[model samples]
Target: MNTQSYMTSYEILVYTGDKRGAGTDSNVSITLFSKNGKQTGKIPLKNSNNKDPFERKQVDKFCVKGDYIGELTKLHIEHDNSGRSSGWFLDKIVVTDIFDPKTQYVATCNQWLAKDEGDRKISRDLTLHKQQTTTQKSNYYKVTVYTGNKSGAGTNSDVSLTLYGNLGEAGPMKLANQEDNFEPGKKDEFTIECQNVGELNQIFIAHNNKGLSAAWFLDSIVIEDLYAMHTYQFPCHRWLAKNEDDGKIARFLVPQSSTTETPQIRKHNQYKVTVFTGNKSGAGTDADVFITLFGNQGQTGQIKLDNEKDNFETGQKDEFIVECPAVGEINKILIEHNNKGLSSGWFLDRILIEDTQGHRTYEFPCNRWLAKDEDDKQIARYLVPRPKVKNNQYKVTVFTGNKSGAGTDADVFITLFGNQGQTGQIKLDNEKDNFETGQKDEFIVECPAVGEINKILIEHNNKGLSS
Candidate 1:
């Protein structure tokens, strides 16, 4: 007696083919896949083409969503002993998704079983959780056959099981012990090689007599497809930086220029750099801008710059580079007027400064630095307090807010309260102003804090207060 097992949300596909010749038997029973690797749900053969010499049978059992256990676990194909003949045979047996069976079959064939002609079985038994018999030996798998409705009943056949890489090609099956326990309609078992089983992508089971395709009783089958998850890099390019507030560039750019010309100077650690002139504010033409790169003891590297004169746009940016000297010391960068053209009276806007002073070379995070003004004035840094999730839930309390701009008078603070308790304050606003905002915001406190919220008080240094 064979018991079938089933899992949730799975469908079983079974194909049954022709029973021709004098000793053909069309009685085949397919089984469900068992969680224990044993056949479970055994369904009887419903459709048949008795008159046709070539008969192919197929059945589909779909389990309800999340009902994986109802899927087939085991299949039992029994040949009637009373009507048995000498030349009974079985052909290719396949189990797969009704929509896609190719991928499953190919993947299984290449991974699990052997690749031989007379040693491979066209039909597979998915009921087995593990390839218990097939993968037992070091480089070989075994197949055991039983007889009739009885466990150990019936006689063994004199035939052998063959393995194949695909359904078309012959040989290359790489199977051995082909003549071991050959049983047809009776209880029998045998082993096959496992070396060249690389092409078995899916689960397939079937049997054949001699070298030709034959029809035999078959049971249940199951298949699974596996995929590898990994991370890979592809080709991509970086975009040019627009301004200091925009973002930082991953790499520096090289400009085309000659030794006689001077280039625009950029501050260290700054992502954005723009230049403008006061003299020729409108008459756009090539102006001589002398750029000097100095190293230790007045030493210098390459003086690279663009040959084309800059038009000095309000927001446009260009690329230029300074090479480091062999000595590797603090290098001073200066930009002067060589030709002193009409637009030589230009001024720098977004002057980013990079730290090339210390012995250790470490580029600062783009957000940490800003351009300097006439008196070397830098932008003020503001802080924004981030709150943690409250333990006592207040579904009504909303914490939507923002921080003020640098130098702006915005006092940032959070007025948190619970129950009838005094309000707790957390400040994140600038000295000049409290906070910035596009619209209004609110928050709700949980039940435990509800009674303490009524006595809420606002604590802030800068900016105004509102209810």
Candidate 2:
């Protein structure tokens, strides 16, 4: 072992040659010795052909003991002979420190080759390569915490981080300082060493009540792996309070840019709307619940909920499946009730709108009474519809089964038709392909514009065959 501070192991490359008359059955072993002539370990050399002459081996996580200097003192090679014509030749031995395995150590050999002729023993004095101490660098991580927009409402001093890695859960590592206790509208950055722990997989933020206010409005968190030069951001657009159900918010801090896209109308024309009536103290059942839908093109007229069974009642809820004739993207919604009198108004709690394709669901909250003088205000919000499934491509599975009197294989052809007409066609045996009997194959095809699939035409060259 060398005195290099970063060295923790050693590797040895042994080169053996099979020379004629070198005694093929000879066994050669190399024994390592400490400073006081004490044997540590023995490595037997497996003889290999001269064409491929190198055998690499390593001794990792090894340390010398006692009054010995941090180096291998000597190497002793022992040989035993078996009655054979071909002999073994010790070509060379290369020793290197684990930290810099390419740098070799210098050795003085007392006997270079071990053979069956006369002296059957050999020894060598090994000396490590003299080099400057190299220090191992630790990885650094920078964490930036952002407080919400509220003024003077910062996080507490007891804010900590839970880091998950290969070494298991490391800590709720404390992030505290007296000067700035994660104040609102302020950014606090903390640097941490990640050497002791393994690679980070996920992170969680824990908040406690130890500052000026117990409630901490969090905006976001940004973490940077300094050594890897990568950054991750976690959005926390919520409050962190002491009395909250959970004081910790966990998230995957992935590095990605935020993007926004215009919502698109789904293929189906039907939509489901569920309205929940509020159970407030002053709430009352109202007549004629009028709801209007707003889209990208234009707005719909007042669609009156005249059905008595579907009207909103205090502490009661109802759902309706409505069909829209307009073809555009839904962006907003408005709900109002006919307030016949002050005691006959609807206290709407929330309304859920679901697209017919089940692709998008929008929830609108209304915490006020409709048509109740001061509380009679319209509830509306902008919404973006999510796609239920990818509509661009569809998987078509083709089943090929032979009936009685039908052959074992057939050349099949298929044509698919949508609302607009024939979309695609493929011949299974256009390239002389064969669909084996009782077997199935799948193909992917691009879907036509959103509509019902009209029909499918399948033909086979072989007679009496069905697909």
TM-score per prediction, in order, is 0.20, 0.27
lDDT scores for all predictions?
Answer: 0.30, 0.52
Tell me the tens digit of each residue's lDDT in model 2 across 133-165: 334324567888888778645755477786644
For residues 225-341, write the lDDT of model 1, one tens digit per residue. 111011111111222122212222122222112232553333232111123323323322244443333445342322223436454443344443332222233334444333334
Q: TM-score of model 1 relative to the true fold?
A: 0.20
Model 1 misplaced regions, further than 4 Å = 1-6, 18-28, 33-39, 44-75, 78-90, 97-467
lDDT (Cα, 0-100) at 292 in candidate 1: 37
